[model samples]
Target chain A: EPEVTQTPSHQVTQMGQEVILRCVPISNHLYFYWYRQILGQKVEFLVSFYNNEISEKSEIFDDQFSVERPDGSNFTLKIRSTKLEDSAMYFCATSQGVYNSPLHFGNGTRLTVT
Target chain B: GENVGLHLPTLSVQEGDNSIINCAYSNSASDYFIWYKQESGKGPQFIIDIRSNMDKRQGQRVTVLLNKTVKHLSLQIAATQPGDSAVYFCAESPSGGSQGNLIFGKGTKLSVKP
Candidate 1:
C-alpha cells in the first residue's frame, strides 16, 4: 500500500513567479513522471524520468518546465516562470517497470497562478 | 496526434447496480492500456489495466475488457457503491515507450446514487 506523497497540496502564486512541486515516489519504483490536468480537460503527460535523465517529454513540457530526481527518493518539477495558464493539478507518478506495469499516482499538487 | 476519448461525459447509476464506461483510442501502436479513477481535486487512481495481448483482466470488483482490433476498452464495476462515484479515464502507451509516459483520454464522470 505504499503511495507517492506530494507536498504543498495547494499552492497559489503570482504570474511570472517561480514554483517547485515535490514528490516522493514509491521506494522500489524505477520510473517517474509528471502530468497535469487543467480544469475540465484530460490529464496531459508532461515528462518521464528514468535513470536520472528525461526519457521523454510532450510538447506541453517546454522550456519553462523541468524535472529532477534530486535524491534517492525525491522527484520534483520546477516551473521557472509561471503563467496564468499554468494553473492546474500537477500529478506525480511512478511505476515498477516501463511496460505492462500500472503507474501509481500521488494525491496531486494544485497549482494556482494569479 | 493520437488521442483517447470516452463515449460519454457522464453516467448515472443506482447504487448496487453495475456500471460500465467505454473508451476509444486512435493509436494503433498502443499496446498497453489502463483505467484510472479520479475523485474531485485528486490525482488519477489506478483501477485496472489490460495489455494488447489480453482481451480481459479483472481485479476485485472491477473488470476491464480490451478489443485490440477496434482499439476499444471498457471498464465494468459490479455492485457499484456511492464511493465508486468519480471520473474515470483511460490511458494508452505505445509499445516500447516508457511506462510513465501515458496518453490519457477525457474522463467519464460516474455518479452513483442510493
Candidate 2:
C-alpha cells in the first residue's frame, strides 16, 4: 500500500510571511490535490493538478497560493503572504486519475499564522 | 449551489455496537461518493466509497450506501471499536467529465466507548 507523505507536520509563521508546504504523493498516481480544513470546519477543496497543470481550482486558491511539482515526486504549495485566516490543516492527496478511484491523503501540514 | 452536509455533529456508541453516519448532497450529477475518517491531528483516511450506480457496497466491517434519488449517503460500521472513534466525513464528486473536485460534508465525530 502506497502513501502520501507531507513535511513540516506543524508550521507557525508571522502574518504576511511566506511559507511552502511539501508533499510526496503515492508513486504511479497521476492526479494530485490540495485541500484545507479549518478548525471545526469541513475539508475544503483548494486545487487539483494533473499532467503538470492545474485542472481546476476553488475560489479560495487566489493569487497568493501557488502549486508546483518541482520534481518528479514532490508537490509543493507556496503561500506568498500568509494571513491569519490561512490557519488550517492542509492535506495533500493523490489518485489514479480514474473515476471513483480513492484519494490517498497525507497526514497533513498544520499551518498556524500569528 | 451544490453542497454536502451531515445530519448530525456527533455520535457515541458502545464498543461492539454498530454505528451509522449520514450525509446529503444536493448535486444530482454527482457520480461518486466516499467516506473518510480523521483522527484528531491527522488527515482523512479513506474508508469506503460508492457510485451513484450502486445502492450498497460493503468492505471489511464497513458499508456505504448511496441513494441518488434523495441525494443521500450513509456509512455503517459494524462492531465499532475504540479505534473507530474519529471524525467522519462524506465527500462527493461530480466526475462525469467534470474537473474532478470533491465537496466534503461537515464531519460527524464518532466516539466509541471502551
Candidate 3:
C-alpha cells in the first residue's frame, strides 16, 4: 500500500527558532491534514488543506502555524517561532478526497523545542 | 464543542485472548468514526472505520461497533498477539464529511502479554 512519507524523523530546535516539517502524501490523494500529539495526550487536529488552500483549521492552529503545498505532492508545516510546549509528534495524513475515506498517516516527525 | 474519549488509558490482555477498547464522543452530529493503532514513535495507523448508518463493521481480525444513539464506539480484536500491542485511538469527524479533519481521543494503550 502507498504511504505518506515525512522527512527528519526527529528534529531538535531552540526555542523561538523556526522549523519546517515536510511530508509527501500518496500520489493520488487529494486531501491533506496536520495533527499534533503531545507526549501523552490525545491527538489534536491542526489544519486541513485541499485544492492548494486550507479548507478548515482548529483553534490550535494560530498565527505561528502555517501550512502550504509548495508544489504538487509536497505538503509542509512551518512553525514561525517554536516554543517549549511545541515538543510533540507531528503527523501528516492524506485521503482520496471522498466521503468516508480513511486518511493514511505517515510515521510522523518528532519535534523537540528546547 | 466536540470531544472524544477512551474509557481506559491502558488494557492488558494475554496472547490469544480477545481485547476490546471503548470510546465515547460528545458530538452527536459526528457520523464517521475510525480506530487507529499507534506504535511507539509512529503515527496512528488506520485499523477500521464505521459510519453512523451502520451498527457494526468487521475487518480481518478487528471489528468496529458504532452506536449513534449512545454516541459510543468500540473496537474488538480477536486472538490478540504481541504485535497488536500499541496505543489505540478512536477518532470522529465532527463535520461528518469525508473524515478529513478528525477529533481524536486520548489513546488506550493495549499490552499483550505473551
| Number of clashes recorded per candidate | 0, 0, 0
For residues A1-114, write the lDDT of model 1, one tens digit per residue. Answer: 999999889999999999999999999999999998776577889998989999999999999999998777799999999999999889999999746789999999989999
What value does DockQ give for candidate 1?
A: 0.47
Q: Give per-residue CA lDDT, model 3, range A10-85, as digits (tens).
A: 9999999999999999999999999987775678889999999899898899999999988787899999999999
lDDT of 3 at B48: 95
Q: Residue B112 in candidate 2 has what lDDT?
A: 94
Model 3: per-residue Cα lDDT over B1-114, one tens digit each = 001243447899999999999998879999888999988777889999998889999999999999888899999999999999988989998764434889887778899999
**Distance from true position, residue B96, model 1, in Å?**
3.1
Docking class of 3: acceptable
- C-alpha lDDT of all candidate models, in order: 0.88, 0.88, 0.88
Calculate DockQ per candidate and list them.
Answer: 0.47, 0.42, 0.46
The pairs that clash in candidate 3 are none
lDDT of 2 by residue, A19-50 (tens): 99999989989999999987757788999999
**CA shift at B6, candidate 1, in angstroms?**
12
